[model samples]
Structures are given as C-alpha cells and as structure tokens.
Target: MTTVFRKALGALPRLGVQVLDLGPGAAVVSRRGGYTATKMSGDSWMVGGKRPRTRTTADGWGLHKAAAGDLCARHVADLLANYEVNCVFDVGANKGQYGRQLRELGYRGRIVSFEPVPDALARLRKSAERDPEWRVYPFALGRSESFEDMHLGWKTMNSLLQPSAYGQRRYKRFTDTRKEQVRIRRLDEVMDEALEGIAEPRPYLKMDTQGFDMEVFAGAGRRTADFVGMQSEVAVLQLYEGSPRMNEAIAAYEDAGFAITGMYPVTREKTTGRVVEFDCVMARAAAAPSRQG
Candidate 1:
C-alpha cells in the first residue's frame, strides 16, 4: 500500500498537480489544468469537475517528495517524545552532524557525542560549544578498550575498519587516504561513568560509525537494556572489511531485546539502484506474557 502511494505521489508533479496541506492527514491538490482535489476524509475526496455521485477514500493521497524529509524528522521526534528520552548517545559523531540534525528536528534533550578523530573532534567541539546540553567526548567506542588506527577518508567516511575494495571502487571518497591513532573503549565499561548522576536517564542511542556498528552494540553489553531506543547504520553491501551485513545487524539488535521499527536509506549506488547502507531505528521489544499458574 505504501509503495503504491509513493508511486502515485511521485507522479503528481509531472502531471501538474500541486499538493497543499489542509491539516494533519488531509491535503488540497490543485492541478495546473484548472482541477482541484479537496480531501473530505481519508476515504472520501471531492473533485472540482462535474459533481460525480461516486466518492472514494483518498487514503495515502497527501504524501509528496518535499514532505518525505519532514515526515521522517517528525517520526523520529515522536519516537523521542514517546519514549521520553532524556539523553541521546551520539556514537561515532563526526563534526556533531547527527546531533545538530536532531536539534534542528526539535529534540531538546541532552546529547552526548563521541568523536575520536583529531580534526573532526575539534570541529565537533567548536560546533557544540554554544549548546551546553550537547557534550563532546574525545574517544571512540568499540568491543574493547585500546588504541586503534582509524582509516581517514575524504571527509566523514573515516572508520576503524579498512574499506573493502568494492567500497573504494564504488566511492573514491571512501578511500583510506590517511590513518589516525584514536582511543577506543568498551561502551559497557564506560556507560555508567559517562552518564553518571543523571536523574532519569532514558538514553536514545544513535550510531553512525561507518561499518563498525555491531562491535559498538556488542560493547554495550547489558547496558543495552538501559536504552529505550537505538539507531545504527547497517550495510547492505560489504563496504568495510569484517562489517556486519544488514541481517547480522538486525539479529544482533534482536538478541539485545530490540525490534526494528524503521529503516532509512543513507547511501545508494546510482547505477545499480542498490542500497549501500541504511540507518535502522529500533525500540525495545515487548516481552511475552508469563505462563498461567
């Protein structure tokens, strides 16, 4: 149903129709050819043409290209609100872009960002200096505590893992142009220390650590239960050496009591229309009922 609606909505602009929002879940569509479509209800529409006696439900009519981003942003904002998330762990935060986006989307909660790269950390600190609620850390999270060589890419594509040959071939920008030694620590070991003294810490975790998401999750260990929701970047293709594939990432989250709620494509190959990576939003899975005595 969503696919059908998306296809129909995608064809609207080409047909000279402009979609105008009337209110929540309703819209007024005007065509350049002097026709107007006013949504009366989810299941009813009024056409400006000859008063046709038949009326049909306009269920999925208002979705448009320009509104997709807004829809996603609102969806995430609602999730944060629903869970009453007080703190967001912005893992693999490079230049605090994810944190900034969350703030732009109206999330007023506290944000703790972790970035290990020297230059990137500097920029992240600068960007977050004005926001007292947004804190920046100078370390990376992984399966264990140690120092590791980070592969630096053209811009924000740096990762602890080496890029696969296919990754370099598909996107030259992901090529490991240089290396930086960064401090890495296990999230479980430092979770309490990092989030110390929070009165009500309902943490929402968001990770964009290139292809090292699974390791981060593993490092979270029992601390995963403390989070109400999490979002991580998962690969559809093998972009980095030893990176978990989409299914593997999903299974890991499931094992940690999380259920996949949403997925948004982050990168795609233009030629093949294949998704390279996507961000998966997960929430704590509901527990099954106990057996009757």
Candidate 2:
C-alpha cells in the first residue's frame, strides 16, 4: 500500500518547482502547490515569490528543487533503504522534514528526532504529534552539554550543527535575534535510554547535526557499535577547511569497528558544477563476535 502510495505520488503530474533563494540558502516549492510533480526544471527559480538561484531536486520526489545542503530528498529515501534502517537519529531536525521524508519513503521503523531551535523544535514536535514512534528530542546536539553558540537561520537553514551556520559565521554576517543556553547532549548520553525507548533491536543513525557530525560520534563512544549504518550530513568544506572530512568520518567509524561502504553526493547534479556540496556517509557495523575474536 505504501509502495502504491509512493508510486501514485510519483505518478502524479510534476512541475518545475525549482529551489529559490531564502536569502542565504535554498528551499523547495511545488510549481503545482505541494502535490505531485514530473520533470523538474534545469534552471533556478523562485519560491514564495523570492528571486531564483541555482537549484536541484531529488531523483524521485520531483517536488521542486530544495536547498537541503548535501542531503537531498532522493538521498533521504536511499538512506532509508541503503541502511535497512530500523531506528534513526534525526539530529538537527528542522520542522521534522528529515523524518517526514523518511516516513514518506516508507520507513516504518522508529525515528528519534532532535532539534535545537526552540521555534523549530515546536514545529518539529507538532509535525510529530500524530506519530507515536517518532520521538522528537528538543535540545542541541553537540560535543557536550556546553553552551555552544548556534546560529539559527530561517527555515531549514536553522542549524548550529551544520556547515551553513559555520558559514554564516565565516562568510556571511547576521545579527542573531534569539539566543538561549540550550542543553547540548551527546549521543552516548541517551543511547541506552533512547534505544530502549524505540522499537528496533539495533538502530541505524542518520545524523544531520549541522557541521558537528564528528563530535556526535565521539559522543557516541563505544555504543556506536550498536548501529548498523550511518548517513551523516558532514561539513567537509567548512569544518575540515578543504580536507576530506568524509575520510575522517571513515576513520572514526573504523576506530569504532564500522566500515565506510558507500558515499552519496548531497548535491542535485541537475544544477551546476564541482561546487557541489553534502555527502550521505553510509557506514556498516562490524561483526560483533569477530571484533571480539
């Protein structure tokens, strides 16, 4: 039924709802008003009546172009299947869109969502209101419980754990409207409780914690072994400053006994050049007994 639903959704007529500028970032629009879509446009277009810029869409969803950094809608579904995901850690969840995308992809397993922005968190909670398994965590994910200065942008751009926030600090200048001391928690801090709280025997992690991908795993510690795979939104450019942050992530997984199997470019190829951004890192868990052996 879900497959049929997805197909039906896929079969519906699509539009060239390209992603437009949210001033500093991108957003998706339905040229047909948030319904089904077909061939997306190759050029940049505006949404919410804003000016257009370079944009792209996911492979399947045809629902206009979206600027979700490296993590696109197609990647969202791909991660759901690729990881054989049971439980997901939707870190840096903005308005529960990541979780919604996964659910829309027929991911029926548990979803543990976390978001930091108070307003965004509220919307995230409201989005998850009907679902029981989709647990929306309201807090900032980071290296620790320290007061990490997070820049909250509008829409999906609201992130302290993403490259955009870091970029907002580095490249762009903005005056922060609301700043609060959010409780920054590590993954390891809530693993036992979180895992016990969900349905899966062992859950996979889908981390899009802004640019703080590495530190979340670091916080995961030894319990990181419990995950089957990971799809993280890594900040390869800003955080690593042009070095391979993906390789660094692989090393972290290796240290934790996981292997980096596949990588997905987070950009929509239909747009433009090598200036592509984002990668969904898929790491498979090492055999437990063999690791001990």
Candidate 3:
C-alpha cells in the first residue's frame, strides 16, 4: 500500500468513518484489519472497497470507496440516486448537533427531537430555540409510555436508559448529572398526539439512544411511513462488554423494513490499545417483495 492509502485510513478515523474493507469482498465483516465495525451480511449495502487494488481512494472525494461526499455515502451512485430525505425524527437528540448539522446543510423540513437527560435536553433546546422547524421532546422514547427514574450515567452527556450495563465509565470531560424523574414515550403514540395534526407527510428517523434503538422501534409500532429513511448511532458489538445484543438489533431493524446500507464511526481511540469505535447505520425502508417491482 502507498503512503496516501495509509493516510486515508488514518485520516478519516478521526472523523469516525471506520467501515472500509480492502479486498477479498464479503469478508469485510471479519476484515477488522485492526479497526472496529459491526459485522454485516446480506445485500443491505450502498458501497464497497473489497478489492485490495481499490484501496487508494478509500477516502477519496467520490463514492464507491471511502471519499467524503456531501453526506459521506461511500458510493456516488447511491448518494446521487437515492431518494432525498427531508424530515428528521431524531431520537435521543443530545446537544442537537445532528439537528444543527441538518440545518447547516440547508435541510428544509421538520426536525422532531427526543432526549432524556435534563442537561442535554436543556442544551439541545437552547441550541434549537431559534429554529421554528425544530420540535424538541424533552423525554426518552422506548416501548414504555410513562415516566421513569433513569440513572444519569457518570458521563451525563453519554447517559443511557440502563445504567448498570455501562458498568463504570469515567471520562475526564465536563459532565454533570441531576437525577430527577424523566418522561418516557412510545414514539408512535407521541407522534399520533404531537404531530398528527400536521397535514404534511411523516419524517425520516434517527436514533442514538445508547443501546436503546430496538426499544424505540417497538414503540414506533405501525407508524412507520413508506418513504421514511432511518439513521442511528448504533453500538458496535465489541465495545461495552455485555452490551445489548447486536443480532437482535439488526433483526429488529430488518423486521421494520430497514436495510442497513452504510456504517460510519464517530469516535477514535486517543491511545494505542484502546481502539477506535462507533457506527451510525444509514438505512432506508425496503419494500415488500411484491412492492419492489
């Protein structure tokens, strides 16, 4: 491999783009090659870099490899051909960075957000206060439709519904917590009440509630729209020992008609032995066999 090829891998790691394979095809799942990624199968993909000879532009400017396009789709054809997504239902929307990014990119549609931690809720609310299109939900969305006393993980910014599952995580970053009761909602129910009146269409959904994506999906019930696209900040199997089951998650999403098309990292290990991690699964609703034609 050339120095540029090596640099592409090393450079994008900083921005959290870890899902790249350098040949032999289908074996990318086991292509750890020292990096961390969710093992995948089936045809739910929009990009490929399996050929060892195709490693040069793995992080180039077009798709089909690893270059950074407008939204990081590894394949140019997918980026340019896929249906355009406008509305966003952002579950577990921490500081509203996702929302901000959408706005920065000139996304002109509704952004319904959900967050559990009070600190994050406040910050997210303030960050989006000026945007009329942003509707922030100061609560967590799960299978339950009631309030619960969720333990604010030590890193309040990285809080989760099940605290003990995190064992003990202590980051030196500035994080604080105030444990008061927080509301939980079944996403479908909340949408029925809060957004039912809107004459416009439904929105695309993004979930990053720790390992709580499946729970949120269940609460969504049959409320899923046909044209909806979904993105999630999913947890990789290797991180957080004893974390939620990955197969169950993939199956749950598949059941909901979402095909996992792409995965991107968002955090890199600052040290040698720690490891780089995080995958945001980009998915789209798949039609039934009968509807595909």
Candidate that scores best on lDDT:
1
Best-to-worst TM-score order: 1, 2, 3
Worst 10 residues of 2 by lDDT: 56-65
Candidate 3 residue-wise lDDT, 1-293, digit = tens: 45665665556646655546543332233233343233223333344434354544323222422222233332312321344444568887888877887776557677888887877888999988999878888889888777866656454335444434333342433134445677788887777555544575545677777667777877888886543566655554333343456556666677777777665654433332231234445455443223333
| Model 2, position 278: C-alpha lDDT score | 56
Model 1 poorest ten-residue lDDT run: 57-66
Give stretches of model 2 more than 4 Å off.
Answer: 1-84, 159-178, 197-200, 239-244, 267-272, 285-293
Best of the two (2, 3) by TM-score: 2
Error of 3 at 16 (Å): 36
- Error (Å) of candidate 3 at residue 196 is 4.5
- Number of the top-ranking candidate, with TM-score as the measure: 1
Model 1, position 113, has a per-residue lDDT of 91
Which regions of candidate 1 are displaced past 4 Å? 1-71, 286-293
